[model samples]
Target: MRTLAATAAALTALLTVLAGTTGTAAAAGPTPLAPADLTGSVAVTGISLSWRQPAGGPAVASFRVYEGGAVVRRTATTSAPMQYLGVNTTHTYTVTAVSSNGVESPPSAPFTGTTWTLGMAPQCDEPAPLTVFDVTSSALSVRWSVGRASPQLALTVNGRDYGIVPGTSLRVGGLTPDTAYTIALRRANCDPRTAPVGYATTRTLPGATNATAAPRNLATTARTDRSVGLTWPAPSDGSYVHQYAVYDGAYRVATTWTPSATVTGLFHGTVHRFTVAALDVAGNESEHSPVLSLSTAACPVLPPSPSRVTATAVTASTLRLDWTLESTAGSYTVLDGDSAVATVTDPGAVLTGLAPASPHSLRVVGSLPGCPDTPASAPLTVTTLPGPTDRPVAPLGFRVAQPTVVNTYDADVPLSWTPLPGLAYRLYDGATVVGTYPGNAVTLRTRGAERHQYRLTAVNANGDESPPTAPVDVITPFLVAP
Candidate 1:
């Protein structure tokens, strides 16, 4: 009887274990369907993954997202925002659906997605070209095609990057005038190779400062037949004056940095009204100053001086004086000492009857009708050639005059003689030849209270000397102050 009881207890324990196994097996739920139509889009910060709801399966309670082989996210909606993803990195994603009973479905085909950095480029259509217009000294206006608008797009100007607000056009300010700028359209997360670039220059604006006052005290400083010199006090505000403009009547004749200018190329003997104005660097000009009326002196005014005088073609009894004239309307007078030796209308003249080897002082004066002679030109001293030796003659009228005081301790004896044309005269002190001259007069220097004897001879062109003239004696006296 005890053995029978033991078999029954073992059978009951077996049945209890079978029933518990069957109950646990019944608690397991049905499999769900995989997500379908998986797709993704990239943004500057992250990527957005989306899928269509799976159909014809156990009721889906949620979705699971797998990156590579690891599960990364779980969501109840059809879209997933993968935030804080790595930039420029490819992420392999697959979606699976979970049932209400906690049963899971097989993952759908892998759907690859990528996230972009701030400057990372995406594989997409390029945006339209940017349009730039309304450029000014400190600002500019820009616009672009409407279809090209994107949150990741930005405008770069002169190395400064700017964000695009919600608008079709943008105005950039704080620019500089007359400066070149590089303008580019870039996507925040775009490839550098595809960034659209352009160039533009800003326009310069007129300055605000204007020269307020006219030049003061405009007056003529000098006047000539063809030119007038003018001067003025710089404008009280000199900083506004870039230059001074001088005007004759309505015509601008000169521009100068100082307060003075010369107006030239005017008609002689005519009256003119002159004025001055100040010009600023921005090209703004002040009002003209008070008028200055002046008349040029009449014609025959001292002609311009002659220049470049030269003695050429010298001979025993003649020489030619060549000079340059500033004007051709006047005649030239050749002078010896204070006397007029010859007159010529041309620039050249010849003086004849000059003693041989005689030094002569010559000058030229320009004369015009009804006008005083021009000042004599600078003197040109020249000597004539001696006569032929075969016909040499002694100087005549050789005499010595009374002594005259040369300085406090020196006296000069005046010697005079008749000069022969084309002959040089030699003066002697006692037996020694003291000096030679081509002229008729000479002075001998002597100490006070001295006695001197003088004689004269003539020299020919061939260097032959004539017989000496009779000797003349003179006694120099020292003067005593009373």
Candidate 2:
């Protein structure tokens, strides 16, 4: 019994020694070494693996490629090309060498390869070809092609299969406007377990109508002695209206891009009628809107006070004022802080030589020949924009320095930049001003693992701002380590 046990132990030791051999010997022909530098190149639906034979290895009889411990291919050469793989799939493989006596070496390191994704994957025919030829608000036309003739095929829309479609082309209707859809083509008797032969995605067009209807809510917005200001809503037919036509009875007086227009050069003490119509981008004209009728003021009538007064700063040292009157044939005066700054015959006046970054109160007064001047309109205060000259320059060398941890989820990010004399700074996160600092540095508190962009602008005493500096990005960590 002892002799028999010794013989079995010696046999196990011999097998262990053979298994541990790394070099291939010509005399004994032990198991060869694993192939080295095993690498893979992937195609649309395939992967090819290549390797170099290890040094000191015996002449290889064949090479085996293993996937998940199963031999998938055996090739006599150092390279193997595989086909018919799943699209956009990742596959891992290892290579091994086989000796002439049917001895297999250990597997090489794993190599991962991914097949081509959508867009690069081979389309229709081999995969099936589907095309969307026409798209409408509620319908679309689709055509498909196959390499071989099949008696019947199926059309699947959004996972619902319609069995046994007759031809390669189909007109699908009853779709919702501005909706997305997924379409596929398959064999009529295709197995539920397999993928479709062809698939595509598309969106239906939005609903629209012809702009042939008249505009609504026509009215007079302002009135003057010789002119009428009119306004109306655009046609509500989901069509783009690029221009409008103002009409006086049968005559076209003016064309404008806005919904409002003013007609001038009319006689005082006269009755006038005005109407508006909309024009689409395709130059299609809509029916005329309802008419608005009013009479202009006579010569001896007292001028009415200006209404709807508005003042806007056009530049650092200029402003524009507009107002409406019951009769516009009279003279008008614009007042700035109780001082007459302009006198004009029109409803709009531009005032120049004003101070930059300063606020002023404005109003308008109207008067006619042989009539008393009308009362001034309510005061409107407006501030001018920053001037072009003598403003601070943009910050120099702006950067986000190191961050100091505040807590588990918060940190204080330090920002530094070169300072300018007699100028304050405004720090902006995107378009929002986050802080105003008199010095060159500021610390901002942030939370989460988020990225933030910052820009710096210099502010002068008049509230004029310089051009913003280039933006810098900073990211904060989700957690702080002790």
Candidate 3:
């Protein structure tokens, strides 16, 4: 007998060939059957039911299958030698035959089939052909050529399998938005699962905080009414950064690979400060750099206040004064006895045209271009014509270390000076002698009206007092020993 192969569909084509009637060729009448001559029982997945049967002939039209007290049908022919006695509703199943003349035969025997049992779980197996095909920012699709192997094969995830659903593809949702997740696949088909076979890991999408390396060298330049052009190195500096964030203080200005950013809607003729930060793939942001400052072209703003104004008695007609220079100081003025004696555009203030041996009161004032003038320094009494004789000679080999932070005038600040074999040395607080050290270093308590002044003078064997030297403001007392 010839068996015809069917179409491309697996189950449809397979069943089409097996669904034919018995004795299509030259077989004779139906043969006699006995339970003792029956073949062994067979089982298959997805089949509603299965059975064993004895051989017979073409005269038999079908078989009567029995379960519990009711009757079910298979092929409806005794000679077909094949029947699908599906055990859908009953506990035990048995099969008998029916002839073309409608004669019913005795029940064949009963056997127990597969069903759900309490505490009886399916066998667990590794996923077959579990392969990842496509990966995206938030998901990865994997294909596994895995199916049920037993009467009831369950699909397992992580460790346990969920039974019933017969679909192949399953979506792994609720995964981390932008992180790696370890997935372990499992298939349960036994009473007790041994272990899951398939294991895989994949990364997910990323948010803004999940940056690795941030931007670098973010600076602003070129100005219009309200627009400013900002230039940066790159988003991913040599691939160190996964992305970048351009921020205007607290808010993000832009996010992308664009190296240059144009910021508008700024106040005209006003200067603004901006900053840039970088991020890497691991979500680590680098430290922020120094603030880059830029401004629009406007009239010069008021200058900052001046500090630490020092006056040196130059002469009666001329007094030279120095001050710590800052960009904000527009001009310096020398006031004598509440009157502006000299006003100079230069940072230093010089006062001239004064009477000799006169007790003149002087004050230094700092003023900006448009801002109000501020008088900070107190009235200083500067006398003139103490003459070139007051000039002092510095002791030989003078070296001292001043404290930048903790300065105590009484503290012993170490000093190294050239050894003067015969000349006696004296330390002066301005014109007055403050101390005399037998050696190069001497401990002197800095004392004065405004600040401590220090100078060194040497005496020859003739007992002549050398002129006084320039003094320094010892704000920190830690430098007292000299």
Q: Each model's TM-score, in the order given?
A: 0.26, 0.23, 0.23
Task: Give a tens-digit lDDT track for model 3, residues 1-482.
Answer: 11232112212322111111222344334443422112122222111332223334423444555566665333321212112222121245566654544445566665444422212322456333355534434334443333223323244434333342222233332233566665554544444445545566667566334233434577765776445788877644355655554544223445545567776534334444455555456433443333456765432233233434555544423345545323234456767787866555444544433443356666667764454665455556655433222322446665456634233212344444554677677665433456666666764433111133455656544333444344344533322222
After superposition on all CA atoms, what RMSD does each candidate show versus the true structure? 54.5, 37.0, 46.4
Model 1, 405-460: lDDT tens per residue? 76544578888998878888877664355887988998877755455556677866
Candidate 2: C-alpha RMSD to true structure equals 37.0
Rank all candidate structures by their lDDT, best first, as comma-separated numbers.
2, 1, 3
- Give the lowest summed-lDDT range of ten residues in model 1: 14-23
Measured with C-alpha atoms, the lDDT of residue 328 in candidate 2 is 33
Which 10 residues in a row give candidate 3 its minimum summed lDDT? 13-22
lDDT of each model, Cα atoms only? 0.60, 0.63, 0.44
Q: The CA-based lDDT of model 2 is what?
A: 0.63
Q: Per the 3 Å backbone cut-off, how many clashing residue pairs does candidate 3 have? A: 43
Which candidate, 1 or 2, has the higher lDDT? 2
Model 1 lDDT vs. the true structure?
0.60
User: Which residue runs does candidate 3 get wrong by more than 4 Å?
Assistant: 1-281, 284-305, 386-482
Per residue, candidate 2 scores C-alpha lDDT tens digits across 357-451 of 67888888887555577778777777665454455677898998877667655668999999988888878664356888998898888753445
